[model samples]
Target: MLFVGGITLLKNFERLMEAFARVHERQAIPLVVVGFNRWRFENDLAFAKSHRASAHILFPSFVADEAMPQVYRMASCLFFPSIYEGFGIPVPEAFATGCPVVTTNRGCTSEVAGGAAHLVDPFDVEDMAQGLELVLSDQAYCQELIARGRARPPTSASTAAPVNPWIYSSKYFTKLPNRRGPRASLAAPWGISREPLRQCQTYQGTNYMLPPGGVMVDSPDRGRYI
Candidate 1:
């Protein structure tokens, strides 16, 4: 079974369904389009009926999130050919569940997949056909992707959050100053290379780096120190 989502203009709904229709003509696959918005649903239904391709088009808009796992499990792969995205979270979520993903190469989708998913041009029907064929025809390749996805590390949020100042200092500031200041020996308590100072120079009570002279003194705080 194949899962489809949404019918918005920017969602590439028409291109996706058209690709599926072409693929199905060659080999029939059960497709269920999960939809929202009653008017768009009705319009899609009419389009499907008029095209005489209603057999494979099933609309199940009421499925709950908890049951989405069963839908993912039932399918061999998830097909998404969106033209653009800010960050494609669902691609990784599907990967976490052991479902192989076939999505477009644009936007953050490619970056998120990290070679775990097959990428194709969303605007090219032929490329989409080839991608679907590759996955559905080759069981070994599909399993390789699934296993690779399983080995992928979980996302970390600290990447975006403000981290402790000490961590940044310890990791990067460990390097010695290129040129020492006049009183580098005394005022710079992190002495030449001796006992580490709990705190470095401060500009107006704020932590700052020592000047080129590497001198630490009671001089008035300057804005450049920061």
Candidate 2:
């Protein structure tokens, strides 16, 4: 079974669907797409129907928190290739549920997977398909992933929440006495090398980072950290 969360473009739904079209030809692996985003789901379903792959795709809308484990239990693997993410909670969650994951190296998925899951390119359909095939074809590889996943360390309490602007800002920045101003520290994620960050002010009392290459921040509500 292949499990994906949403139909959003960034989640790489279309590409996963394409890969499944190829995967189904090799073996009829069932796809379970869990989400409640109406417009996006409709769009992705339309694409699947057009490709004649809808028969193999199952849409289960708005799965509750308690039932999520059972959902994970039903799957042989979790397939997530998000182009970006605040952090991939599902990666660790899947690990906890004893489900091996095939995810992208994009965003924080790799960080969260910690080498437990198969990492693939989110952009290329064939690469994604190959990864799927590899994990499914090799019991040794799948067991390695599951064993490593079980042994993988839990993410930090801060990481329990999605990696957000607040992840970089709230934890790293300190406010001066009498609200003199907000100052961001050079601190990076734990065990990471710290770099120098110039002083900057907060937006609406919320600290954010504007890095050298580009200004980026994660919205806790939106789930994208950019």
Q: Which candidate is the best by lDDT?
A: 2
Per-residue lDDT of model 1, residues 39-146, tens digit only:
376676677666645677777758765666667767778887778865554565566578888888987777777888889998898888788878877899999888
Please report the TM-score between candidate 1 and the true structure.
0.63
Predicted structure 2: lDDT? 0.69
Error of 1 at 12 (Å): 1.3
Task: Return the lDDT, model 1, position 182.
Answer: 45
Scored by CA lDDT, what does every candidate get?
0.61, 0.69
RMSD, one per candidate, in order: 14.3, 9.6
Predicted structure with the largest TM-score when compared to the true one: 2
Number of clashing residue pairs, candidate 1: 4
The TM-scores, one per candidate, come to 0.63, 0.69
Off by over 4 Å in 2: 157-226
List clashing residue pairs in candidate 1: 180-213, 181-213, 181-214, 181-215
TM-score between candidate 2 and the true structure: 0.69
